[model samples]
Target: MSKTYTNSSTKFSFALRLIVVYLLQLFIKAFDYSFGGVFPLTFRGMIFTFTFVTYWLTIWYASEYIQKKISHLNTISIVTINVLIGIYCGLSSTVIYMLGDTYLFQNGDLWEEIPFYNPELSVALCIIYLLIFTVYAYVQKIFQLKEKEVNVEQLEKEMFKSQYIALKAQIEPHFLFNSLSVLSSIVHTDQNLASEFIIKLSKTLRYIIEQNKRVLVSLEEELKVVEDYFFLLKTRFGEAIQLQNDIDPNVIETIMIPPASIQVLVENAVKHNKLSQKKPLCITIALKENLIIVTNNYDKKEAEEISTGMGLSNINKRYQLIAGKNIIIEKNQDTFKVSLPALSTIDHENFNH
Candidate 1:
């Protein structure tokens, strides 16, 4: 048999609340007796107190049942049902009290002194039920807020980890080797152009370093990095690799995205596809329907590239954390395209700093 672990915290809370309600009932009874100018610890008083505690516990159980069943109910229906439950609890408490007085105490005058049905007692019980429900609701709200805070913290940590991993991948030994080889080839042929290429490569590296400290960057800033990266690519491959850019000026300043997103997409295109004079690789960047679309021809090399495929996966995870959106990837026989979310400046500021 499987052993079931009971929720100790829930049981402790219920016990504490029961003690509080019992003390509150005693206080109210004492207040009433003060007016009568008599207070005594009689057997009748002990029995009455016990009955009251039992009555409140019944209402507590009923409230739990209502909460479990009526979650999907509309506001009006839930309120109506809860009100009826309170009325029933009030009526039941009065019956339990009268029965204790008549049978347990053996008091013949109970019928004459305290009537079988007391409207005032029922109303008072209903009010108590409402107060109890209100307190329960407030406590539940506090728990929900705490849970949400924990979830947000976990997500922020995951986002930062993804970004760090992507940076490591971009700055690995193989990438540095290729870039240095390109720079070495141009040094003898065109010294001025080689100088410009070195500057562009430096600028691209500087941007990556700066952006690693931030969760998001403006589209305009990201575009500058992309331009520098493309300049290096164009210098290295010359006419073999071409970038076709058509970006809207208005969207650049207003929209934001995770740092180095466009560069990763462009680098992915270059890495997977073959580039030569006969079959030039042409990559396109454009804006469409509130998204930044980056596409390239699907001319995959015969051998598969050695990669963990974390480029797009990391970008997608970061987008979800920053904008609560998804990156759309589409592939056909000849084209591969990815559409990224274009977040507003306000949305960018709303993320965890």
Candidate 2:
């Protein structure tokens, strides 16, 4: 905090604490006088102020310290400890306060004691405060438990996703068959182009393999794989599949993204959409402010189970888990769009290790 804010906050807290203790003292001393009598406006009123303030601060701080120490104890044990702390703090402070009133201010006169020797009721104030603190501690622990659950769930998801993507890339039979089949035909006509296709396909597989261990990757790094992946697809589909990207070079260097995120979206479009000479599938990737936008023509293939939306749901979960951000999806009759938050350097710093 800034110095000015700290000073102001301290003053405010002191004033508020004084007000609370003053009201508490008034409530405690109310029964001493009859209905028509005025409230204490003399020096003894200062003694009343000191009484509640002393008990309040002592029991509050003591309960806080000891409750934290015994947090692992069961409910019944915790309650027993709290009751002991309250009686100790409340009775000890009240007795000392009474003794001080008799000796220091009243010259050891028993009749001039500040309070009328009712320590038991005064102790109830400490018990009430202990109850409040116990409830607070339980609520705080619940939140901590929830946070741990989220961290564990995210770890499990990352593990499953890495294995799923890596295994699918390595074992998907159709992808290899089509690549090699395309290569066989092209190698007969142009050896150089066929070799380039083979190299790009190899890089595509290598990138997926290497990136399985990562939760996040640089935009430039992921974009290189996207380009290679696109080349492999273009080799097989020819002019039927097209990609349009207009990302800033500087943005790509400074930003981070989930590895293979763009590639997955492109592949998803090609998988469930019709791509032919009649109406080609066009996918566009662009940057709009802090969002990386990917949109494709909404042309579903004649297969119901293919549009299950599991792929998009997984992307949403990964974004939320890693960056604490969400990807926005928009779809209509002709186009489907997903706007992903472009993670910056500071954003990546927040990721779980």
Please provide TM-scores, in order, for all candidate models, with all chains considered together. 0.62, 0.60
lDDT of 2 by residue, 8-45 (tens): 64565456546665665566567545212336666666
Against the reference, the lDDT scores of all candidates come to 0.78, 0.73
Please state the error at residue 314 of candidate 2 in Å: 1.5
What's model 2's lDDT at 33? 56
TM-score of 2: 0.60
Pairs clashing within candidate 1? none
Error of 2 at 251 (Å): 0.8
lDDT of 1 by residue, 1-353 (tens): 00111244366568867986697567546644422322347767766677777768766876878788998999888778888888887788778766866687776464566566677777787777777777877776775575446545645665677567656856889878988998898889999988998899889887766665677788898988899999988877889999988997776998888889999899889889999978999999999888999999999888975878688888887777566689999999899999998888786676636
lDDT over C-alpha atoms for residue 313 of model 1? 84
How far residue 131's Cα lies from its native spot in candidate 1, in Å, is: 5.3
Alpha carbon deviation, residue 190, candidate 1 (Å): 2.9
lDDT of candidate 1 at residue 249, scale 0 to 100: 77
